[model samples]
Target chain A: MTFTTFMQHLVNSISLGSLYALIAVGYTMVYGILRLINFAHGEVFMFGSYMAFFAMTTFGMPWYIAFIIAIILTCIFGMLIEKAAYKPLRDAPRISIMISAIAASFLISNLGIVFFGGIPVTFPRPDIFDIRIVIGGVSIISVSLFIPVITAVALVILLYIVNHTKTGTAMRAVSKDYEAARLMGIDVNRIITFTFAIGSSLAAVGGIMWALRFPALIPFMGIMPGLKCFIAAVIGGIGNIKGAVLGGLILGFGEIMIVAFLPELSGYRDAFAFIFLIVILLFKPAGLLGKNIAEKV
Target chain B: MKRNNKLNIIAILAFIATLFILNVTLDPYRLRIFNLAGIYVILGLGLNLVNGFTGLFSLGHAGFMAIGAYTGALLTMSPETKEMTFFLEPITPILANIQLPFPIALVAAGLVAGAIGFLIGAPVLRLKDDYLAIATLGFSEIIRIVLTNMQTITNGALGLKGIPGNANIWWIWGVSLAVVVFMVLLIKSSYGKVFKAIREDEIAAEAMGVNIFKHKMMSFVIGCALAGVGGALLGSLIGAINPLLFRFLFTFNVLLIVVLGGMGSITGTVLSAVVVTVMIEYLRVLDIEMNLGFIRIPGVPGLRMVVFSLILLIVILFYQRGIMGSNEITWEKLFDFKNRIAKKITRRKSS
Candidate 1:
């Protein structure tokens, strides 16, 4: 509990928090527009990490190139998910769409099991990533500092696109009222695809960072984090991007701090977010930043 | 009332027959799996009440079950074994002293589980659909993580072992059958209609004076309680229980059962429970080595799980409506559908 140790843990928690925030933004954006949970986002993140792994190991590409390739493919893949699983069910009940998303997620994970095998594999840490930087008498892992920076840049980029762009306006319009947006000559389909692509790309970056930090990959890895990120989205107010980031940091840091400070109850750390989610759902059903989404009775 | 009367009699007769036949001609292992299936059937049906009938997406059934399993495990175990196996000091000494009979333990498990479900449902049931799903999933994980880490009570990761293995085929089947009967009766009542209306349109249901929160909690608790009974049966059948056994995979398996059986369909759930259990067990045969003359190959490990996952994927992709969709087995639909099929066959034969 000294200053140095506390600072070290803070850096660790922040890095972890940033990655969660990155993945969570994707969830919030998609949910904002489509009102679907995008259950496959976790798999998309997994896809990103695996793609990076292949780029670095099989192709022998440089670290940055590997990351770029992974992000590009995941973005395209996310859009495809919308095109394939969702478009057909556009007119169906939202439940069916959610179910379809779950199916797609299961498909991807099982496919991963087939291709990548069931065991956890180590992520390749580049030489630069292995180096730790000392600041203010605390040694921080290079990856630890790198994560928050990546998250901030991604958040800024997303904010700019959503606030200052035509596509963003269209997405907002569609989210508010699909029929109304359609009537206004908004390319509803294109906006959705773009939403999926952007969300997926961000998830890819999160996934990449997650791998570098946790340093392991497995088929079921997404199950816990995916659920937690969804919680982050909910806690921040579903469909609000900034809310999602805030929620993610709160959850990620909350989880790590619980485990770190309450060492005796470290095993219960994972449950902490879930307990918070339940409490939040009970108290502030709309979440921290979520407005009332008046349901049509 | 008419359908209820008819189904009640048929269910009772079937139960008697199953009890008679099971007693007359089945080994413990076969009976065990059948008992497991019955428990799962109950779990699926309970989940169907909330997720299927009420249109609430909840994924915390396992958490409810852990509560029930621990309750039942504590009740059934003797004081000495409880002392020797778990923590140095018994957390619930009353639990250690609770050498309740097997049937009592199972019932207690359901009740205790239902109570926890009530507590959890009060808070999380407000979240409808996907948010509710995440929240509930978190609840389940929290329950598990807490249960795992609470070495003072659940013995942590080492798991609670050597609980009384007294729950035979009859107990599981008896309890499951009772739950199904109870739920079916509930579903046919006026209260059930309100639940369905809420599912169809929550806003409209609320406007129409259906207390949405109450109905959702009712279903959620009942489902969770049944899942608890399932977990208790699982504990009894194995004679020991570990946190690892009830992983997210088990949740997915039960979910597949519900979806495959047809989300809101009781008959579909019963049928699919049989199908999935049999299918999985059949896949277990894949673990055996095979010889094809030219090249002999040993069975790959975890092949059954892979195959099961593949089947689940296929089901989700192509047969998402499952066997029955949201339809139930009412007498009119059954008789009318049967007659229509008969007439079609006769007409074809005549042609």
Candidate 2:
């Protein structure tokens, strides 16, 4: 590939990876705390994008204001989903919770179709994001630059919250041992709720960034990305936060680079993430960054 | 036990009689729905083997079904239809002229799916819980993507049309009954106990001398084979085969039936299969304009799915055991009902 083309692909991978990283954080955090795969997390991301769309169109808010409001709304919706679908079934069998999560995902997407209609909507692009930068004959959109910067900032903030704050300590304690954390005067449920809120807010940011990049909004758009992000989380050692970002970048580059080199297999682009996931799962169930936990017989 | 045997024979006869009567009386549309429900029963039973009986959370049912559907369709399709459908890219020469009878093709499809399932399960069954679920799900997606990319073989996304419709209600229900009987007998055997033991606690089962890998592979393969049979019948019923037909939503529906029917209960799976299939059809009205007494409400295209999903969510949250709660319909229960009927008749005569 030419230098300019290589540069363009690199830029594209970075932007895509940022989105995956943002979504994967939500998946990893929830899995870390609850030992539950929150299948509805992607729907939370989809809700965020749609919220941004509605805030701009229906409420006539400016883009920046709408973005902030959308993230906040998405956080509330995420928590609401947990409370309604997951909270009651906390003590039940794991299968029930998983089924509930799948059902919630279906419900949210179908409801989105019922409310948003099945047709794809054009995402509103503000003038501020319309700017494009050209470096060494490789043109890059301003949003592409903003995505990675925003993701880096979010990752730093997330690290600070998880490592430094009191709630972060509580979260770590809960994830390590739920009953033990409770015995130590930690409000386990409260920490979980906080985790969901933060995770979902990150999903909103990712969703908004994703929509800004793609410029289209559909009810079921989250499924593929959601699955891909989950794969990314698994690849990065499912419960590790920084591993999620690393895995996202690897997935992003793998997808872009595979298609870039082999145009004949471009149709199989979506399958790459899944195939990678299976291989990683089979050969290394603990993941690249995950520590192996022995299965008790 | 002798009296129960007599009652069981009579019940079987009655059921067959009812099925024959319904087959003759129902219109083509309703017959199609009935056949689809029978197919679903086969699929649900097959899935229940792995998910409900063996306790392995596999989400690759769609992939297996796709393999079966494509295999059955390709084998049964005439050269003319194959030629017509492969206008985008010519089909492979070896597959072009081969045509098998529907039943043989369906069996072959099942065998192929079973073999593939064995291969996939050999490596994947080692993973536990959610990891297995995700890996299986990934395999299914890979199958879909491969199908979409391999235009010469699968006709790409354009899909194959004009396959013979050999899936009548009799054939569908006949296969469903055979599957049910096989499952019932299998569950009654020692192997079934082993499966249940694994489901209850795999490590303990392993400690108890059960070969977890072999038994899990058996469940996965058998389940996949039945899914394949269902898919073959479905292809024949629809008279078309496509990658889109075996999308994750199809697996989702089957999963819903298996869960709602009470996971290891054969009777529950069969009953819920019929109910869920019919309900899905019944809810079609929600997607269309329904003109009530006065106001004609505009139809919402995706509202039925919304309602169905909500129901599934509520059912999982509040009624996790579902309608059957792992209970089977036994001979004793049937005999008790018969005895009650006899008592009512005797009391009427006395009165």
Candidate 3:
């Protein structure tokens, strides 16, 4: 491949990796605290796209304003779902909660189809994001360049919240030991809710960025990405945020490069992430960066 | 105990009577639904063996079903139909002309699916809970991708259509009833106890001299074999088979049925299979417009799915035990109901 083409592919991988990382954080954070897969996180991402879409088209709001509103709405939506569907089942068996999460996701996507219609909608793109940039004979969409920058900003903010804040400490304590965190005078429920909020808002950013990049909106768009990002989170060592980013980059580059090299395997692109997942689970269940803990009998 | 024997005989008679009535009275559409329900019963019972009794959270039912579907369809279809269906890509010469009796084809499908299940289960059973689940899920996706890519075998993404309709109410219900009986007997057997012990605590069961791998593999193979049978019947019943039809949605619906039936209860699974099947038909009304007074409500295409999912959530969140909660309908339970009725009559007379 020529240098420009290679550079274009690298830029594509970085942007795609940023989107996966953005959503992977949601999966990693929730899995870290609750050990529940939060299957509906993808639906939350879908909702974010639609929320932003509706806010812009139906409500006639500006793109940035709609984007911010979508993020806030998604945070509330995430917490509401946790409270209604997940919180009561907190003390129940693991299987039941997982099923509930799955049901919630199914419910949301189906409901989206009912409300938004099944046909793919054209995502409203603001022209500002469309501006193309060329560097050394390589042209990249401005959105591609902006996505990674946005991911970095979100990651920095997330790191600050997790390291320098009291809520983050509480979240860590709860993740370490739920009962112990409760005993230590931490409001465990609220911390869990907060985790959902932060995770979901990150999903919103990812979803909006995804819609901006791809620009086609479908009710079920989140299912594949959601599963892939979950795989990403698991690859990075599920509960580790930084690991999620690393995992996302690998998965992103791996996916793009596979098709770039072997176009014949393009039909099996969705299968690749899942195969990677199975391999990782087989050899490194705790993931690439995760610490292994012995299972208590 | 003599009374219990009498009750069992009566229950069998009642089941036969219901099947006879159903065959005589039901329309073609309703009969198809009934047959579908029976197939689901087999599927649910199969899933319960792994997910409920053996405590392996496998999400690969769709994959096993697809295997059974393609195998049975290929075996039962005549060369003419095969040629027409596989027009995009020619069927393998060996599979092109082959046709087996329905029962034999079903058995072959089961065996094929069971062999693959054994292959998948042996390695993945070593992984714990969620890891095992994701692994199985991945395997199912891989199966779908392979099926989609292998045009010679599966006709690729175009799918196989116009297979002869070989499944009927009798064949479907008879096999389902046999599966129910087999599960009931198996659970009462010593092997069932071992399976339950593994599910409850695999490490403890291993300590108790239960071969964890052996029992888990047995459950997985048996469950998958049954799933294959169900798929075979479904393909014949529907007269079409496609890779897209075997997506995770089918697995999700089966999971919903299993959960609604109470994970481990055979009786509940059977009852809920019918209930869910009928409920699915009834819910289709949401996709048809209704006129009330002067206003008309337009039908929404996907509203039924939304409602179905909401019901799943409500059931899981509130009635977590489902309809059965590990309970079974035995002869003794039937006798207890009789005793209650008799006592109520005696009390009224005394009053």
Candidate 4:
């Protein structure tokens, strides 16, 4: 591939990878604390895009305001999901919780179809994102540049909160041992809800960015990305936040580069993430950055 | 023992008699739904063996079904039909002219599915719980993507059409009954005990000298083989299939039956298979415009699925053990219930 083309692909992969990282954080956080896959996280992403879409089209709100409103609403919706689908099953078996998660996913997506209609709608792009830029003879959409910067900013803020805040300490305690955390007077439930809120807002941001790049809004649009992001999390060693970012970058780069090098295998683009996941899982189930914790009897 | 044998014979006869009556009387549409239910019974039972009894969370059943459906379709289709379907790319010469009988096709479908399951299960069954679930799900999607791309073998996204509709009530129900019997016998044997042991505590089962891997593989392969037969039966009955037919949503529907029926209960699987299938068809009313005297409710296209998912959520939250709760319906329980009813009636008359 030419240098310009290589640069173009690099820009594309970074944006895609950052979007994946943004979403993968949610799966990792939830799985880290609750050990639940949060299968409905993808639907939350879809909800964010739809909320923004409606705000733009129905209310004619400005893009910035619409995004803020969408993110806040998505945060609340994520919390509501935790309260309804997961709260009651706190002491239930892990399998039951996972099933509930799957059911919740189907329920929300199907409800989306019923309410939103199954037809695909064009995502309204703000003029700012529509601008094209050239760097070193490689032209790229401005959003491609915007996404990685936004992701890095978000991750920095997230790391600050997780590492430097009191609630972050409580979160760490709860993840280590729920009973011990409760004994230490930490509100385990509140920490879980807070984690969900953070995770979900990130997902909302990811969703909006994803729609901006792809520019298609459909009820089932989140399914593939959702699964792919989860695979990214698993590859990064599931519960580790920074690992999720690494995994997402690897996945994004691998997908684009493989398709770029061998155009014939472009049809199998979606399979690359899964292949990476199986390989990573077989070799390093603990993930690259995750600690190797053995299963206890 | 003698009385139990007599009761078993009587129950079997009654079941056959009922099947005969339904086969002769039911309309084509209803019969098709009935056949679909039979296919689900096989699918649910297969899933139950792995998920319920063996304590493995596998979401890859759809992939095996796809394998079976495609295998059965390819094996049974005549060269002329194959030629017409493969309009985009000619089918491989080896599969083009072959047209086996339905029974052989069904068996071949099961074997092919089983072999694939064995191959997949070897590496995947090592992961525990959720990881295993995700890996299996990945494999299933990979199978689908491969099928969608393999233009010559599967006709790509165009799908297979005009498959011989050979899945009559007798054929489907007959196989379903055989599966039900096999499940019952298997669950009663020592291997079944080992499966239960592994499910209850894999570490302990291993410590006790059970080769956890072998039994898990065995359960996985059998379950997959049964799923394959169910898929073949479904494909033949429907007479047309695409890659879209075997999506994860399809697997969820089968999972619903297994969950609702009680994961460890064969009888419950059978009962729920019939109930869930019929309910899916019955719920079509929600999708169609209804004029009830004064007000007309416009049809909602996706309401059925929403409602179905809601039902699943409710079941998982409120009634996690489901209808049967790992208990089987046996002849002794039936007799005891009958006698208790008889005694109650006599006492009421005396009073």
Candidate 5:
């Protein structure tokens, strides 16, 4: 490949990687705290995009206003999901909780079909995001650059909240030991809710960015990306924030490069994520950056 | 024990009698529903062995079913039929001419599926809980993707049509009955107790000299074989097969049956399988536009799935134990239930 083409691919990979990182952080955060896979998370991401879609198309809101409303609504929706589907099974077996998450995911996607209609809708892309820029014989959509910037900004702000703030400390404490955190005056439920809210907003951001890049809205569109992002989280060492980012980048670059180099294997594009997932699971179950904790007898 | 054996014989006779009556009387559409229910019974029982009894959350049933369906379909289809189906890409020369009897094809399907299961389960069964679930799901999807891409072997996306529909009510129910009986015998054996022991406490089971991995592999392979048989029967019953036919949604439907029937209970699985299969067909009313002379309601395409998923959520949240709650329906339990009701009625009358 030529230098310009390679540069273009690198830019596109970074954009996709950051998007995966954006969503992976949510999976890592929730898994870190609850040790539950939160299978419904993909639906939450779908909900955010649809919410933004309706906000723009139905309510006639500006792009920025619609995005904000969508993110906030998604945050509330995530908390409601936890309260309704998960909280009741807090003390139940992990498998039950996981099943509940799966059911919730199925429910939302089906509901999306019933409510939003199954036909794919074209997302309203504002003029600014639609612009293409050319530099040194390489042309790229402005959204590609915008995606990475937005992801970085979001991550930086999230890191500030998680590492520098009191709530972040409580979140860490709660994740470490639920009962101990509760005993030490941490409102475990609230911290969990807060973590969900933060994670969800980031997913919303990722969803919106994803919609911008792809521009088609389907109720079930989140399934593949959701699974891929979770795989990314696992690859990065699921509970670690920096690890999620690194994993996302590796996955994003790996997928793009494979398709670029082996055009004939494009049909197997989806399988690559799964292959990577199984290999990582078999070889390094703890993930690249994750600490290996011993299983208790 | 003799009386219990008599009861079992009587129940079997009654079941056969009912099947005969239904086969003779029911319309084709209704009979097809019964056939579907039978397929689900086999599928649910297999899944129950893995998810319910052994407590290994595997989401790969659909993949094994796909393998079985394809294997069964390829073996049973006439050469002429295969020629028509593989017009886009020529059929592999070896597979093109071979045709086997339905019974042999069905057994071959199960064996092929079971062999694949053993290969997959050997590595995947080591992971616990959600990881295992995801890995199995990945394998299932990988199987599907491979099936979709291997156009020569599977006819790719066009799928196969006009396969011999030999999976009539007798074949489906007979296989289902055999599976149910096998499950009962397996669960009653010492091996079954070991499976339950592992489910309750893996460490304790291991400490007690149970080769936990061996038992898990055995259960997974058996469950997969059942899924394969179920898939093959379903393909033959419908007279068509496709990779899309065995998606994760298919697994979810079977999972719903297993969960609603109480995971570990054979009786529950059978009851819910029939009920769920019938309910899915009945729920089609919601998908079609209805005309009430006074008011017209337009059809909603996906409402049935929405309703079914909501039911799953409610069952998981409130009725976690499901219909049978890991308890099978035994003669003693039935008799005790009847006596308790009789005693309650007598006491109420006396009072």
Candidate 6:
């Protein structure tokens, strides 16, 4: 392949990886706090895409403004989800809570189908993104550049919030031990909701970008990305923020390279993530970068 | 143990009577549904033994079922067809020409599925619940992908078609009943109690000298094997099989059923399975245009799923214990206090 084509693919991989990482962060964060797989997080991501679509076309807003509105709306919805479905089951057994999460996910999903319908709506690409930049004898879509930049900004902001902020410290403490943190006046519930909100907002950003790049939106679109992102989160070490990004980049690049290298195995593209999941679970149950959070059972 | 034994027999008798009455009275349609429910019961009971009883979260059931269904389908196909189909492949002349009977094929399916399950369970079962859930979920997807691509053995994505539909209404009900009986008898045994004890507290059970690993593996194997049987029956019932049919949604469906039925309640699981199946069918009927002269209603597509999902969410929110709690319907419990049937029988006898 030519140098330009190679750079194009590299850019594509980075963009793809960023999207995966963004979604993975949400899954990992929720799992970190609640010790429950928010099965509905995928649906939440789906909600973001639809919300952005409505904001742009239905409200006749500019693309950038619509995008911002979508992100904010999605984050608000994420907090609401925690309040309505998940908050009540705070003290329930972990398994029961997981079930509640799954139910909540299904509820959101069907509601989305009812409201938006299941038809694949083409997300309108902005004129600026439609332009092609020929950098080194290769043309790349404008949207490709934005994904990584947005992802990096989000990542840095998240790092600042998590590392430098007071609330972040409380989140860490509660995640480590809820009862102990609660005893220390951590306001564990609020922290957990904030974590979900932040993570979900990030996921919405990923989803909106994903729709723009792929240019197709379906209600069930989030299922695959959601699953792959979860796999990424697990493979990266569930609670580690940087690990989620690493996992997503690996998966996104790996899937693309696998398909590109072995053209015949395209059918097994979906299997690729699951295989990684199995291998990781087999060797490193705590994930590659995850700290030892084991209890004395 | 003595007290539990008396209670067990009474429950067993009552269950048997109920089965007998249902068998006698149920129409072929209801009987077919009951049979399917029974198959699901085996799956739920087996899974309950592992997840509910052993505290191992396995979601790779569809994988084992796929193995069993394919094996059964390959075995039961006519030898003439096999020769025509797999003639170029390395399949031996004796093997390719061999046509197994229905019963042998069924047994072969379960055994092969069990062996595959054992292989999958061996390494992965060592992981804790959350890790295991991801692994198992991956395992199911991998199985689907493998089956979809393995054109020689599985016919790829088109699925193993043209198989005989050997699952009569009686066969399904009979097999399902047999499985329920087997699980009940096994769980009632000393071994089964140990499984329950492990579920209650794995560390405590371990301290009390229970071999956690062995019991966990055993339950996983048995549950997977039953799923294999159910898959074979499903293959027959559907008369065609495709890899896409066993999606994450299929796994989600069963998970929903098990949870809604009260994860630990045996009767509750069976009842939940039947209710879910019938509910889906009923929803199909509900998606139609029916109205008076002044009102014109239109038939809506996919509304059923939307509503069904709503109902499930509401059920989890309001009736979370489902139709039954963890409590099993004991014979003693069934016969407790005053009821219309008991009073009527006594009055008739006295008169």
Estimated TM-score for each candidate: 0.93, 0.98, 0.97, 0.98, 0.98, 0.91
Task: Compare candidates 5 and 6 on DockQ and give the better one.
Answer: 5
* Candidate 4 Cα misplacement greater than 4 A, ranges: B291-295
Interface RMSD of 1: 2.7
Q: To one decimal place, how large is model 3's interface RMSD in Å?
A: 1.0
Q: What is the TM-score of candidate 3?
A: 0.97
**Clashing pairs for predicted structure model 4, backbone only:** none
Please compute the TM-score of chain B alone for each predicted structure, in the order given. Answer: 0.91, 0.95, 0.96, 0.98, 0.98, 0.83
* Native-to-model Cα distance after best TM-score fit, residue B15 in candidate 4, in Å: 1.8
Could you give candidate 1's per-residue lDDT for residues A64-173 as a string of tens digits? 99999999999999999888788877777776677677767777787777678788899999977779888888997788878899899989989998889988888888
- In the range A1-297, model 5's lDDT, one tens digit per residue, is 899999999998999999999999999999999999988889999999999999999999999999999999999999999999999999999888988998999999989998999999999899999999999988999999999999999999999999999999999998888899999999999999999999899999999999999999999988889888999999999889999998998899989988998998887888998899999988999999998999897
* Ten-residue region with minimum lDDT total, candidate 3 chain A: A276-285
Candidate 4 residues A104-138, lDDT tens each? 99999999999999899999999999999987899
The two-chain DockQ for each candidate, comma-separated, is: 0.47, 0.84, 0.78, 0.83, 0.81, 0.58
- Give the C-alpha miss distance for residue B297 in model 4, angstroms: 2.4
User: How do all the candidates rank in terms of DockQ, highest first?
Assistant: 2, 4, 5, 3, 6, 1
Lowest-lDDT window of 10 residues in candidate 6 chain B?
A: B85-94
Any residue pairs clashing in model 5, and if so which? none
Candidate 1 clashes between residue pairs 3 or more apart in a chain or in different chains: A297-B203, A297-B204
lDDT of 3: 0.92
> How close to the true structure is residue A24 of candidate 5, measured as C-alpha lDDT?
94
**Clashing residue pairs for model 3:** none
